[model samples]
Target chain A: MRRLKALIKKEFHQIVRDPSSVMIAFILPLILLFLFGYGVSLDANRIDIGIVMQDNSPQVQSLIRAFENTSFLNAQVERDRREIEKQLVAGKLRGMVVIPTDFTRRLINPDDTAKLQVIADGSEPNTANFVQNYIRQTWVNWLLQSGLSEAMLTVDERVSIQPRFWFNPELESSHFLLSGSIAIIMTLIGTLLTSLVISREWERGTMEAMMATPVNIIEIILGKLIPYFVLGMSSMVICTIISIVVFGVPFRGSFITLAAVSAIFLITALQQGLLISTVAKNQFLASQMAFISGFLPAFILSGFVFEIKSMPAFVQAITYIVPAKYFVSCLQTLFLAGDIYSVIIPNVIGIMILGSVLFIVITRKTRKRLI
Target chain B: MLNRIKNLVIKEFLAIWRDKKSRVILIVPPMLQLFIFSFAATLEVKNVPIAVFNRDTGRESWELVQRFEGSPYFTDIHYIYSDKAVKEYINSQKALMVIQINDDFSSRINSGQQAEIQLILDGRKTNVSQILAGYVNGIIDRYNRDIKPEAQVRRSSQNAIRKGKLTASPFLSPASRSEIVPRNWFNENLDYIWFTVPGIVGILTMLISLIITSLSVAREREFGTFDQLLVSPLESTEILIGKTVPAFIIGMLEGTFFIIAGIVFFNLPHEGSFLHLYFGMSVFLLAIIGIGLLISSVSKTQQQAILGAFAFMTPTIILSGYATPIENMPLWLQEFTVINPLKHFLIIIKGVLLKNVPFDVVLEHTIPIAVFAVISLSVSTRMFKQRLE
Candidate 1:
């Protein structure tokens, strides 16, 4: 027990002395939180589209005016379709609306249906969908306001859909994205902190010297694990505070539950990192392995930004192995939907199972003597 | 001098290739990530689980429910009997949304009276919820149009009559309605895979090359071999070249492999010339290597170098307009993305693959990458020289 205490103290001193560890523990999370909270957005707002007004009729002018009134679209009027098409091809425009010259004539004549041509740059499917939906909405609003729809049928004949967005009324994406980023930040700190720990000792020839001492392998592992576990937990706390105070993301779940789940996840990440370091025994290889296996998977497969349900079946099955997926699920619920254990309990169980497997692998990989 | 540089480059490549671990690291993870990213990293929403709370026993409500069941967007539909069940489904995250129809739904629609249906969405999943809302609106819109065929006629003639352009007509045909004919160019069906595969190529290339070059100097420094290299006959410039060459070669090779994989496996369309694609990739690699080497030179240890790379990479990927559009970002943040090389390269590659962009236009985007490469390389070179002295 005394030896374990001494080893932990030494580990703590090493972390305090190393500037890089400090940067990873504190500074990197700050930058990542700010970047994700402000810089990256899934909300498709202020999309630039071209409006080619081939018709100068007053009736067409109201449709153009309706397009102009929308905050979502930045409409640039052009006289020629060819010019707008060039902009669309150049990737300058997301979509373009072309008003035909016969639009007013079609409106006056009951026999002909007036068509507004909407061409979207389909290289970006999300933006293209947004552009199409936004234009369709604008046109529908124009028709309803112009009393054009009243002539066809009475208002009672229509079915109105009242969409109520629960939990997030404004549909602010940053609320959930900020919560999800906490899982990412924890993954970075946890994996990166321990990935270099054991391998760094081996690379610097200190592991051999440590092996000759009175302490056993368990003492060393525990010593290394405890300090970095505290470090990872503190990083989590700092990130949560920033998310709640600076970004104003509501945290409805109990603080105890948050800490408990974060601890389990940090253990899994640290165990995975420790396993890599033990097997590779080289700092460079361990860090690279940690990055490829840890960070990228956490970013893509965790369903942080992308929906896991939308992915292919094989990919969706793979997400079950990604620890971040469970953490993100827990975080989104804890922060937005509160402490609903129906969601949290199963995710916590998944993380614990993965963590136990990693722990078993790490213990098997570690030996008392230097190889 | 040429012989010495060639020897150094060969040594660098062998140093990476000779190690079985590094060999596995270089080839296997990238291919795995390519498949995972191309297949998994998609924004297209599908197979959403939702709950429907219908109180009306009318045929119209059942038809609307059937329409939702037929939609490709939703596959898992839970039919709930009570309002409390709706709360439980959304709270437990068993469903993304609940469609509620009051007892008067079918009766009102049959009587030609306006009926309201409430769609309660779980707003926690912001993007998915909004998209699902759009899908729901579309279903209802089509149902509304199908049921009330007379509503398709436009009353724009009333506006015309108000403007004194024509006399009032009581009845007009359905053909007089103004409709939007949407055509998505480049990708007519808007396949999400084609969009993501090109961007994944950029991301994986950046990651591999950045790790390789960024660790080159730091690895030597950590193992105390950098001092031996400085004592050797090779100049600092030659050593830098040796480090840059392997990373560049590996990056280009990986880029080519992924691009070909995209073409063969994903059936990604290659509209523009391969010349333009390779030209843009080479410049992109140069910029990435410069940034990596800069990190390598500044970092004292391999750990620092890795952290440096991580710090640089996360923001680069986020800001590159890969997952999201750059235009959607704030004006100031959008301006900041100009310094990000991936942002420029993505445009060039996407333009080449999708738009068949002209060479001059490719050059237009490549100019930024070239400028970035020149600046980063010179700064790192100056730093390398200072360290050598």
Candidate 2:
């Protein structure tokens, strides 16, 4: 027990002395959180669209005014279709709404069907979908407010859709993204910090010296695991505070629950790192392996940004093994939906199972002798 | 001087290649990531499971349920009898959304009265929820129009006549509806793979170049071989060039492999000029190598190098308009992305591949990357020289 304490103390001193580990724990998370919160947004707002007014009619002017009124669209009015099409192809415009010359004539003459030509840059389907939806919505509003649709039927006759966005009513992407980024940050700190631990000792010829000491292999693993586990947990706490206090993302779950789940996840992450370091035995190889296996999968397959359900079946099946997936699920629930044990319990179990498997692998991989 | 630099470059290559593990790491993980991420990194929502609560038991409500079932977007539809079940499914995340048809829904629709339906979405998945709402709105609108075709026609004519924008004619017909004719120009199908595969090319190239160059100097420094390299006959410029050449070659090879894979495996359309693509890729590589070397020159240890590379990499990928659009970002960030080489490269690759962009436009994007390359390379070279001295 005394030897374990000494070993843990030594690991703590090493972390404190190394500024890079400190930076990875604190500074990198700050930058990543700030970027995810401020810079990266899935919400499509202020989309640049061209309004090509091929018709100079007063009726068409009101419709153009309607397009300009919305906060969603940044409308640029032009006289020529070919000019705007050039901008669309150049990728300057998300889409172009061409008000054909026959627009006013068809509106006036009920015998003709009027068409508003909307050409979208299909390179980005999300933006294109937004363009189509927003333009259609703008047209519908114009028809209603202009009293054009008033003569046909009463408002009561139309079907009304009341969309209730539960949990995050404002639909702020930052709310979910910031919460999800915690899982990513934890994954990095857990794996990257410990991945180099065993490998650095081996590469610098310190592992042999350590093995010659009175401490056993289990003591070595525990010592390595405990300090970094505390470091990762503290980082997770800092991230959660920033997510709640700074970003104003509501944390509805109890702190005890958060800590418990994070501890389990950190153990899983640290063990995975330990396994890699033991196997690779080189810092360079270990860090690369940690990044490829730990960080990228956490970012992509964990459903932090992209929906895992939307992925192909094979890829979705691959997500079952990604520990971050369970953690992200737990995080989204804890931060947004509160402490629903049905969601949290299963994911916690998954993390526990994975962590136990990793622990077993690490023990089997570690030996007292040099290869 | 040329011969000295060539030997150093070959030595760098040999150092990397001689390690069977490093060689495998370089080639295999990237291909694996390319396949996995290209499939995994999709914003296109499909196969959403939803719950439906039908209180009306009417034909119209059943028809609406059928509409949701028919959509490719939604795969699993759970029918619930009680309101508690709706909350249960959503809270448990078994259902992304819940469609609730009120008791008066069918009766009201049959009586020509406005009926209300509630779409309860799991707001935790913000973007997906919004998109799902849009899909639901589309289905409801189509159902509304299909059920009330004459009402839609009457509404259009009445709207025009009431506005007094048109002269009232006795021969008024029901053909006055204004429809939005939308055409997706470059990628008609808007296959998510096309968007993702091209973006992956830039991402993988950045990853390979950054890891190789950033680790090169730091590894030497960590192993105490920097003093030996400093005492060698080769100049600092030759040393830097030696380092740059290998990473650049590997990055280009990876980029080329992915570009071909994107076209052949994914069946992505190659609409633009290969000359323009290669031109943009070369400049992009130089810019990345410069930044990687900058990180390498500054970092004292391999761990610091890895972390430093990561610090640069995460923000670059996020802000590059790779997964999300840059235009959606705040104004300052959008301007800041101007210096990100990945941002410019994605535009070039996507443009060349999908839009068949003109050479002038390709050059337009390449100019920024060239400027970035020049600045970062000179700064890193200065730093490298200072460190050696």
- Report how far off residue A4 is in candidate 1 (Å): 1.0
Candidate 1 has which clashing residue pairs, if any? A113-B175, A148-B155, A156-B114
The interface root-mean-square deviation of each model, in the order shown, is: 2.7, 2.5
Q: How does model 2 score by TM-score? A: 0.96
Residue B20's lDDT in candidate 2: 91
Clash count in backbone of candidate 1 = 3
* Candidate 1 vs. true structure, TM-score: 0.96
| lDDT for each residue of candidate 1 in B294-350, tens digit (9 for 90 to 100) | 999999988899899989998998999888888778889999998999998998889
Candidate 2 residue lDDT tens string, B186-207: 8887788888999988899999
Q: What is the DockQ of each candidate?
A: 0.64, 0.65
Q: Native-contact fraction for each model? A: 0.76, 0.77
